[model samples]
Target: MRSKTAKLISWTTGGFLLVLAAFRAPAEVTYFLLSTRLVGSALGSCVLPLTKPEDIAEARREMTLDQPPLIPLVRITAGADGINRDYLAPGKPSWTWHVTGFVGFVEGVPEILESTPALVERRQGGWFHDSSGAATVAFTGYKPVAELTREQIFFASAQLTANGMDLHWVDLGANYLYTVETSSSFSPANWMPAPGGSWPIAGTNWVDIATPLSGPRFYRVKAELKSP
Candidate 1:
């Protein structure tokens, strides 16, 4: 992005420098200016179509109930050469522009996640400038991860991580009455009540416990949400 900016600044300054450098050679100076203009024209032509608000709405409508947590994809390009290309608008974008001039139109500016691009006049391939470009639109799809149930209950299923084992359960209106048990052994004698309190609300909740350093650790959750 900085490179693109530098190239853009060069566009403003390069001509002046060329004049100074070619004072002894007037013919070369004229050639240089002409080359710069041609390259700039090419860079101006490589613009990609911007994403439209209607497009995003249509995309969301096309998704099924099974699809959720849509993610958007934005494209960024440094030049017509297509060598320095990247994406914008992932789970989040670095910058966002809003369109407030028009109502019932694209409601907001597209988010930009790629580096800033600048048109760079290059002598390669017979004098051309790089087309620095950004996308003003986005398309969405189901997020990378599958949709998760907001509420569900499990007996012994727990995910172990470096910090601890995360246990989860859905409070089915059982007044959120619940208890947890953990043990290093499978023997009932080794099982004892794990100290914990009720969740603030009767829904899905989670708890984390330190990972056992020795033998395999086990956990169990029993919950009861009272009927209304």
Candidate 2:
């Protein structure tokens, strides 16, 4: 009957190309060994062995140190679904990069971000200390002409002399809200620096302003002072 209807239409197009190659999934190689020293200096090393997964996006290792060696600051391609969303699938395997430093009570991985202490008073510099002491003050009457979406708001509004302090102990302390993406073009594929440009206040003045919308956005106010 016409060669059995052309072999049942070529076995239904070879079972739809074997179910689209079994739903194509492969790509998961994670490794991040970024060494850093100076918290007491001396005791930072890197080893080599079994490294081949396309050479980890162009690997380069070195760390002999009296000073110098904390390379490979970029390879980030996480999986199991998270962080930069798995680079691009294809039979994943191969990852190793160790960064070490923690003498006296060694605990690993549990610091998304932690560094608190912010206090800087200036309208005339009458109490300065911001190099991690934290303090960059400047606020001008509610300036958000428009566009203010809210994923978390409360940028800043300071007035704490510290002596008797009370506002529930200055709202408990530790603040972070960053936002900087001034129209884009700072390179390294935009490594933060363009939200009116000028950054170094990182003790918490609420800086966590991620953007993707469009047009006009400016923010400023950093006051990270706590330690009572």
Candidate 3:
């Protein structure tokens, strides 16, 4: 009886140690940003991160936005299997905005899991004519991933134009011309158009003008009409 008890104790101790070794905290998470240029150079941005529910809540409370940040894009939680699962409209305090341009995760933290491009969808109000006599309207959409396919790009472009706005590469009058592209590697620096030139004319759909900024990546642009 004594010998059998000793063996059982040893087995249990070994199993416990093995389980401890297998348990480890997750590494830094990566978040995705879908950026869109809003009116008056005010880039409205959204950030979507793969994170735990607690972390998401903490981030909202801890992080401060210099600009009026809107909407809690979404929240993701870890499952029993240790995978991050998305939970949209978690009924928590989130931010939302009518106009957005530049979307990204909070800087200096590797907690964000993925990011996507911001798509524009027109709402009922927030439409007006710009100084250039173009119809400028405000729209909202969610960013899912950084790299979008040609077809995905077109749908977003069409949605903007359907609302009576033209998408164009605005000349910031600085060294870089502002434009949008769909590339596997999405970055703000690459989205800019060449100086002294414009992107594929304003009316072309993303399919016709999808340009690869980097390897196997693509993007498109929509000119906001000042007067609808």
- The candidate that wins on TM-score is 1
Q: Please give the TM-score that candidate 2 achieves against the real structure.
A: 0.15
- TM-score of every candidate: 0.27, 0.15, 0.17
| lDDT assessment of candidate 2 | 0.22
Per-residue lDDT tens digits for candidate 2, residues 115-180, read 111111011133222343222222111011111111111112212232311111012122322222
lDDT ranking, best first = 1, 3, 2
Q: What C-alpha lDDT, on a 0 to 100 scale, does residue 160 get in candidate 1?
A: 46
* Model 3 residue 210 CA deviation in Å: 8.4
Backbone clash numbers for all candidates listed: 10, 14, 47
Best candidate, lDDT-wise?
1
Worst 10 residues of 2 by lDDT: 1-10
Question: How much lDDT does each candidate structure score?
Answer: 0.29, 0.22, 0.27
Error of 1 at 28 (Å): 93
Q: By the TM-score metric, which is better: model 2 or model 3?
A: 3
